[model samples]
Target: MRNKSRKIYSMLFLLLFLWGVLWEAESVYAANWGSVELTAEEAVLMDADTGAVLFEKNAEEKGYPASITKVLTALVVLEHTSPDEQVSFSHDAVYNVDRGSSNAQIEAGDVLTVNDCLHALLLKSANEAANALAEHVAGSREAFAEMMNEKAKELGCTGSHFQNPSGLFSEEQYTTAKDMGLIAIAAFHNEEFMKIEKDLRYTLSGLQRLPEGNILYMEHKMMLPESRFYDSRVVAGKTGYTRDSGNTLLTLAKEGDRRLVTVVLKDKSPYHYSDTSAMLNLGFQETEKQSLEDAEGFLEKIRAELVEKGTLTEETKLHFSSKVMLTLPKGETQEGISYLLLEEEAEKKEISAAEAKASDSGMPDAKDSALPHIVFLLDGRKVGEANLYREQNIRVMLSEASPKTKAAFFAVTISGFTIMIAIAVFLFGGGALYGAKNFADERKRRKKWKDRRKKRLEEMKISEEEFRILLEKRKKEKKN
Candidate 1:
């Protein structure tokens, strides 16, 4: 009997040690968003549409963009010139580049269409082509660089200054990770730019062809299937390197209906690629995106309250100003999502219709902001929010617009709403989230999921006492 007691005590001690160790580990794992490690000096991960930052480290600090500036070059060229327009390479364009830099070997007076030059500029990072295209668009490289800077400012970039189109080292030429990410989002959203950059290989048919049959291949290896850093999710990207700049990378990836942009700047080779991959993983794995359209209960509550308060009219059709998305921890669920209407009586009337949810949940936890907007919450934290708009704005914009405006509006609308959102989800925090990817048949009765967890716990030699509560929550949820 004494030996049996000792063995039982030893087992309990082991379980306690395991539990303590796991708890500590989980805290650290989520300490810095799964401790997203990166060697890049500056990096950013963001939603392409809303520009919500998912991850960052010195993202606003200025760093040399190197050849990644070509993405902006491509954007400017697309905006100002047509693909069929012919561009004759001037003597200055052909020879006025940093010697030993990338070039397509085009001779002065060689004429190529803007489309071919773009392929060369993006795929080959050809310095001469960059200058040639710039000269064609704005009459001189200096003029084109000015155009580039103006466009960058217009795109909401605060820490960017452009002096050259080829991204050749210039003392004043620098951009922040945040600025580059915004530029990437704009460039990739354009259909013409998307088509040109997505091509894996292009043989320039320009009159002054390179060494005859030489082909240009995309420098970004992540999009190349055979590269070790290849990620199938990467739809478009750019790569840059220079002694001063180290390395720079910009990547845009799509998973399901979500679009993510990642920028890593001023890092060593391979790590630049690796850092981008890590940021992409961080965004896709660490966060769950919830769309406002699914929150019918919250929407109705706001509508009724607004009507009652005379803030809205009975004929005032309300919808999210845009298709707003809220990103939260992967372990969160739809019901955990709460809101506070920013109003004079907001403190008195917390709309916690779900039980004492109103009074219990500390609403208006956000910093001072504009009034008359709904502030969204999750687990007592402000995740994101949106303002209500009269529905007629969309109709008026669509109806009174010209044919071109209407077509563009429809395209933008479709592009924005292409993805679906879901109810809030909050799972027990672990290094990973265990939310079901499919909800069919209520996760197929959840039996297999439970069995899998049971087997994992058994393998660890854990008893019902340790993780039973965690597993039992699911059982109780299913019963409800």
Candidate 2:
């Protein structure tokens, strides 16, 4: 009873120990997504390539965009008007903007090309430039705002509405940080728009204030080389400010192999630049490109666990059908990646008897044995997935041993076979010897019995003939 109880305790202790190891390993791979202090009420950092959100604070909460609305305005105008096409400013386009707001002070009937207007809209944050572009593209500001809302919906912005193209304060003009990030991400993909936005300095010659060309510098501090907030990694940016909207800044920057888009809305002046810079630094520090070495190491560990659990044979292999170049958060190791082995789907086809026989005798498909997948998770939530399979290139190295390993394996196999053969031979030889000896002993016993019978007949003083007659008479007497 004591032995049985002790055995149960041993098994329970072993299970507990294994569970503790797995729990610790999992804990070591998860990230803490630390909070950052910022002046903006809403902010977000996103991967430009994947549009994956890396960080956010109230990103979905709607707030006034101010002049950052011009990003969408530029997008809408670029759709309809070529950069070289002439856009005429109407009386309303120049006069409808609030008196103190930023503008090029254009007069009615002033004509500027769409490219000049884009430069003014994004670089100078000119309200008149936005109105001129909107009216030229859609015939009215209201119509243009409607187009902006429609485009926002198509871009998957859930909490966004546009009341004006200039981003001027209106009860209905509101957009979330996330929505603006998405818009910037999509816009940056346009080569023409990128070309226009990336310029740090441009002179507007066709404007009514400067037919001789007025030098316009970008308000985005990060793009200026002399500004304290300038980041060499910054590729392009847009800045916004209004009495009601505070400060809003959107920036796209690249460092090493990463391209990031950061948005800060409703931050204090100058703090917008600092907040954006902080966000960009955080994005660069917290995100990393998955390395091939890390992937290989992770697969090895998974392979070992699968082998230990008997779900996978020692010779079974694993591989990715496509390259796994995901940008994941810092502290997220391959250990955070989870896998699932999908059930093998059998192929159905008519087979000839010969083909069936061949298939039954040949090696089975590797996928028939195992189907693996890599699940990408962030903050314990699944974000993406990749299928893992055993391609011909991923053949099990264990199955194909090295020269020395193969030599050792063959030697061991031969030694085992020899031992088995020797044991079989010994058993056969011993059995044969025992059978022969038993036969010889049986022959001797039969001869001795005959001799004893003869001796008995002699002792009874009976001759051969008389012995035979006596034996017959004894048989008859016994029968009677």
Candidate 3:
């Protein structure tokens, strides 16, 4: 009877231990999203500020971008051309798209400004508007495609190529989900593009070419407030689909000041939205926004380096530029973050259209290029960066001339006086010019007198007190 009771008690203890282990495992699994299923063939979620990869699935695999290509189209157009510039549609642009496809209902003779065309290009997914803007800005579709590829390289996209302004399916055109995320990040930072991307409706300047009010409407229905997939946090987005590519979506959302860009490629009808939503929710829950402002720790680090190097005074207050922000996993310390000073002026995570254009053309402004930049790297990758500036009380002493400079000035003055006196005596004497011999002797005597005066002035250097006393005496004499 005693052995039987002991066996039963041991069995119960073993069961309880196993259950505890299983529960702990489940919690960790949930944190890692091991059970979160995704239907997209390729997708990526990235933090806009830190460029941290929160989650991704086959994100680097190349796939068709479809109409998402227009984001790049609008980006390039906004950079190279002004909003008021006019674009005229040619017969080729009007009829070149795949038959039974999307368009802004433009005819061969239709004309619109660059701004209006952008509204049509992005909001209406107007293939015709894309072609017309491309030709107007770069003079041909091939040239515009090259510009797109060049811009893609500048954004650090490795798996992408462009064949046309509009993402009409082509055998040569391809992009990865991660690459689209990069492109979306660039577009999200653009002020003009963001303004156009969020508008549910717009009245184009080409009112005659548009509907009753010359208005263009968005076709991304999911962005509508009443839609089932509508997310209030979504600031801007674009959607695309083709028979071969299936569905593609790109969106930028923010819970607060922390922004995230999510992209999904080769997905079904509702999965694109679901995948994007899942990634966004998980990202917000897992990551924390860390601002690198004038924290005492950071300031101290900067000051220590400056102090140890014996270059800057301890009083030189240090501050980071307000433009940079960091993203990290929740409850994590900044122990892993490291920094290095950059020799060249680094580009900002966000830049204006003019600055983007200027940078692309290899001509950043002089003032921007001169600031000292500190790039923060995490896990050997640049996670955040900003300019480091020193604020100090500049004690500007009145510039005092050195003894050598004073001596030089005094000698020049004495020489000039001697020459002027000789010239005045000769000119005002009312007599003929003296013989060359006599004039030469006079010059020698004047030169000797000037030299003696210079030597005496050099030997009789006065202290600051003596100089002040003499100056006061001169003022009194002048007053009397």
Candidate closest to the true structure, highest lDDT:
1
lDDT of 1: 0.79
Compared with the true structure, the alpha-carbon lDDT of candidate 2 equals 0.78
Error of 1 at 17 (Å): 24
For residues 88-201, write the lDDT of model 3, one tens digit per residue.
889998898999887877778877888889988888888989999999989999999999998998886989999998998997999999899989989878999998877889
Worst 10 residues of 3 by lDDT: 394-403
lDDT of each: 0.79, 0.78, 0.78
266-300, model 1: which lDDT tens digit per residue? 99988988898888888888876877647666677
Locate the minimum summed-lDDT window of 10 residues in model 1. Answer: 362-371
Model 3 alpha-carbon drift over 4 Å, by segment: 1-36, 203-215, 292-324, 338-383, 386-480
Clashes by residue pair, model 2: none
After TM-score superposition, what is the CA distance of residue 376 in candidate 1 from its true location, in Å?
A: 7.9
lDDT, candidate 2, 1-480, per-residue tens: 999999999999999999999999987755656457999999998877655677889998879998888898888888888888998998899899887999765678889899989998988898989998988988999999999998887666889999899999998999999999989887778787889877878887765666787777788888888989889989887888888888998898889878889899989987888888888888788777674336676677766765686656667676666666555767566555544432322111112222454433433433243444455556653333455554332345335434554556668889999999988886688867887888999999999999998998899888889988888999999999
Clashing pairs in 3: none
